[model samples]
Target: MVVLSKQTTEQYAYIRHCNKTSAFSSTGIIPVVDLSKPEAKTLIVKACEEFGFFKVINHGVPMEAISKLESEAINFFSLPNNQKEKAGPPNPFGYGNKKIGENGDVGWVEYLLLKNNQDYNSMRLSVFGQTTDKFRNVLNDYICAVRKMGCEILELMAEGLNIEEKNVFSKLLMDKESDSLFRLNHYPPCPEMALDNKNGENLVGFGEHTDPQIISLLRSNNTSGLQICLKDRSWVSVPPDYNSFFINVGDSLQVMTNGRFRSVRHRVLANGFDSRLSMIYFGGPPLSEKIAPLPCLMKENEESLYKEFTWFEYKKSAYASRLADNRLGHFEIFSAS
Candidate 1:
């Protein structure tokens, strides 16, 4: 039972909890795509259309490597709170614990967030360099492998949309200088939730929000807590799978596709028992690349649903806004024609 800080408790008090529907099937109809098969593109297209999220197996990442990364994460996070805090407060990179934003909403989670670059500053390299070189090596390896898988998925997405393999969408992300972020999230058991609930609302490990990247790849330990919001605004719990990585379209992809694919809103619920860990890699284009609806996807007379914006600008604005606010709305353009 981890204790919440006084300020954090007050922050949580102001958050609006989602309607609990655990009675709803823990398993929603998320499509499963076998990356090694011939039907992979067709299946991925269908899943993107229907759910904008899917499970992928046979994605070419070795299971042992994944286990190693998970084990390393568990060991790092299991350190004493005082020791972990020495890694420093949350920024665009490094470790963060119970990070609360300007809106007074606290994320009941601790994470080691990293940029996918060797030269960038990292807690693993700066703090525990000599002792935890193995940890750093394993994490870097996992990031490279996962990033390769993400590019492969992007190619398939382009093929599905009948776009050229070298189109702007895929090319920008694959550029040598493209930016991506990884969050190794750990949500400890909040046993106090059972005794502390005054309104019978569920404990939110992370508040409901949509990812702003082009796409997101996630692998989690076998602990059930993640949930996705359907088009009907109802919540469906996402069950855990140790062997599969979950793929989700993000707000950038939605805009790139003219809303043909949605960036799903998802959240994590804390249970009174069992700790949970999830490794998420967020994919994005280079900071200078401007994203907007693809001209190829729109009819000649159709208006663009979203205005063009650079990832760098959007990211800075997003950090300043509430976590649950619709950041994409800021880039929307409306016309009466």
Candidate 2:
């Protein structure tokens, strides 16, 4: 839980007012992909190219699983600070508060970051007490379902791009050593902070950044604070829909497509009256997996925009930098024309 001191509150506030504009007011402006549709492949590719993001429906994840995990998470977060601290400082994974990363970024949020594997079980068991088994079961069910949906989306992307191997992207995620991660973020309401602060700022729930993975699937409660930056550099709020999952094109995907797809920059603002809870599944490749522009994606004489690097290399660099840093810049190839 975030303690609301005047200094800390002021520090977390971000100045902006134009985000209230409805960017998705027009039909088809915000890509809505129905996974059950026959043309989903083409639509997914279009969404990746244009927005680096899209909303998915008919994704097959059980509503009971989603709600159950959310309920468990709320119960865990509602615990006393001292008790919750037992989950602790997140030395890469576990419970974390205010501090977003080791690189000095902070937000008005607390979160639990877990690896998508058995290793998270120990830490999870340590926190939930008597309900540990129930919490673990709910989390596992949710992760399993969402992982399947993520693979399906990746396969569709490959098919749409005419890649011979439909599973080229999905295979990495399915690998035994895949380094995927899941995060549950709780942005509590700050009713004490004046919405119309003298500086004209709103509290920052999470700072601006791009996910450093192959893809990211996000689902949040109806409380709206999530915003994505447009190509024109304008910020627009994404209306909440608890039943649907929002997909984000990640840095790895952008590289794999040779820049044909973009990694969207996005952030969250703290709501004044409603607490917001969100779950994000980051689909990553194995640590040793090589990352570079796919040869199949390049034109006959087109140059690779980025130098090759392993997932471990990129992840290290990304974690070392601030939230807003252009992490891909370090690996980008420059021609001395």
Candidate 3:
């Protein structure tokens, strides 16, 4: 009835076509935590440092919201192709990107992007905003829950960094508007896998890449295809933990913090016989902050960790290059290196 930890939720989660056990062998493993505990603070920090990854059970957020978002997204996408395509991102970049039919630029997934702020950039794109009443209402409610989670995490991070919660919230994101997009990725069972071998690989959820922003708040259902890389360069899959969304610092955060936090390299593999769903909340700093490194990140050597580039420029280049093959480039121009 309640989604607590990966163990408890596994019993309740609709288990289907789970080769995730195989994924453990296909992809090893990482640490798991319960962030709400006072003791877990150090453990989680150490886990992130050592593994750049971990899982948590009973972290926060409601299971109801997670289920609602997943169910609604599936329902929206299942609509006749024409209707679903109508909601496709019109902007081409931000929200309303296109729905990939067979072989398109973005790999094997379709999405709906939403922004709570009045982004003139998003408006400039020909993409249609969430106009469907049913979809909009459901999405808005779902987003409210996620926003709360993001804010809570930011505050927790402030404590972890020994900074005031207000400082973190003010420095990071403010309200629902700043440029962020949620991608609800659905990887259909491979056609090739079904007809003949029914075991062949055809699904490609997402190619390898670090999130361009500061942090990615991620949650996946029982479907297993997500993997994170280790320092030794092995890929490990973190099976979705119930109620707790896994958090990975992104490239932006690495630069802002002068590499105190590392952005991980991760990829989505193709599923052979089942559909998969994952939701990503890409959160970043306030609009007022420069896209460049913060003074704090550079204080160690009095050297900035990145080239002096605006957020807009970097992301544009990233998208154009499918995220520069996922190896977040070095900040050399102004770096102490």
What stretches of model 1 exceed 4 Å from their correct place? 1-28, 121-125, 166-168, 195-200
* Candidate 1: C-alpha lDDT: 0.78
Better of 1 and 2 by lDDT: 2
Model 1 clashes, total count: 0
Candidate 3 Cα lDDT to native: 0.58
For candidate 2, the per-residue lDDT at 88 reads 81
- Summarize candidate 1's per-residue lDDT along 126-209 as a digit string, tens digits: 666565667777888888888888888888878877887435565666788788888888888765665576765656788888
Question: What tens-digit string does per-residue lDDT give for candidate 2 at 1-337?
Answer: 3333333376674746764434456454679999999999999999999899999999999999999999988988888777777888788788888898898899989898988876466565477777888888888999999999999999999999999999999999899899999999998887666554665567889999999999999999998998888898877788889999999999999999989999999999886678899999999999999999999889999999999999999999999999999999999999898
Model 3 over residues 1-337: C-alpha lDDT tens digits?
Answer: 1110111111111213344323554344566667667756565556656665566666566777778767766775565545555554445533232233222344454555555543432342222245344455555666667766666655665566665434554346554346666666666555443454433433445666788776677887777778777776666666665566777777776766666667788877644466677788787654444566656335555766567665666666666565326435644454244
For candidate 3, the TM-score is 0.77
RMSD of 1: 2.7
Worst 10 residues of 3 by lDDT: 1-10
User: When superposed on Cα atoms, how far off is each prediction in RMSD?
Assistant: 2.7, 2.1, 8.0
Clashes of each: 0, 0, 9
Which of the predicted structures, 2 or 3, would earn the higher TM-score when compared with the native? 2
